[model samples]
Target: MSDKPNDLQKIRSVADYQFGKGVGEKLFPGGVKIVHSKRTGRIRHVYLEEKRLATLRPTNGLFSLNIAGAKRIMKHVKPQRLWVRVREEAEPFVARGKSVFAKHVIDADEEIRPQEEVTVTNEKGKVLAVGRAMLSGKEMKAFKRGVAVRVRRGVAEEVKKETLTLV
Candidate 1:
């Protein structure tokens, strides 16, 4: 929290494991702030320049990405992992914080597993929302009913941050 090197290393290592290799450094560059839980005094939220980036889940010990964090991944995480590209008809709704249905998914990373963090993108690679995948990537493509991703934050909710992005 106080520009601690250990904190940075821990978060970066977690990011690499959760997203992919080299993602921790990119997602959380220098100067980012780590906020500890008031009740637990444990690292809880991560921020950069006053904007929240991600939250460390206490139950799973995994990072739940904010829109800002998702943008960083889209920009720096090469070859794209854990992405769910949805249909045109669903883009608007997804951008408004709606869950992505299996029938609407155009394509998804086959390696994605259930309960993992995922970014919902448009056809042109625009990040629309960030969420936990309710189904595996293969299931999203194969199934026609049920939810694929339960969106946490949508781009529409953070229109001001839209310009600060990695499309």
Candidate 2:
């Protein structure tokens, strides 16, 4: 018999399988782990404490799954890539024949502050990109820009304006 265990045929629930067999006890010794049997094979869902950390998606043979928190930290601290999207259709507003307005606006976030990192999203709440804020939520409404949102990665759709209802 080979050192490799037999291919898992199905995984029903947390109670149905051994702790380390599906998720590997070495990686998650005592944390809550969830696994789902897929057509291709077994998929592992790992959590640390109460936060979801990583997911093992279906692969051809073997692969590694990086925890979500680690991925988030890497993206926030030392992003390997950057992206942004134009939220709305805008034309440059010119004053005295000089360009005076930008083509996009960073929507207000309730807790946003000047010079803080923030993720820009569309009306549908899909993240368009991430950038440093040049102005506060209140200031963005009045100021033009020195880099309101740096446009790390531009999405390819026109942002739809949302209507807010006050109760």
Per-residue CA lDDT of candidate 2, range 19-75, in tens? 213333333445445555565446665565654544543543222223233234334
Model 2 global lDDT (CA atoms, 0 to 1): 0.38
Return the TM-score for each candidate structure.
0.90, 0.33
Error of 1 at 3 (Å): 16
The best candidate by lDDT is: 1
Candidate 1 lands at a TM-score of: 0.90
Please give the lDDT score at residue 165 for candidate 1. Answer: 77
Show the colliding residue pairs in model 2. Answer: 53-68, 83-152, 83-153, 84-153, 84-154, 84-155, 85-154, 85-155
Q: Give the number of the best model, judged by TM-score.
A: 1
For 1-167, candidate 1 gives per-residue lDDT tens digits of: 56656888889989999999999999999899999999998889999988889999999888999998998899888988999999999998999899999999999999999999999999999999999999999999999999999999999978845566745
List where candidate 2 sits over 4 angstroms from the true fold. 1-86, 90-103, 153-167
- For model 1, the superposed segments whose C-alpha errors exceed 4 Å read 1-5, 160-167
Model 2 lDDT-worst window of ten: 91-100
Query: What range of 10 consecutive residues in model 1 has the weakest lDDT sum?
Result: 158-167
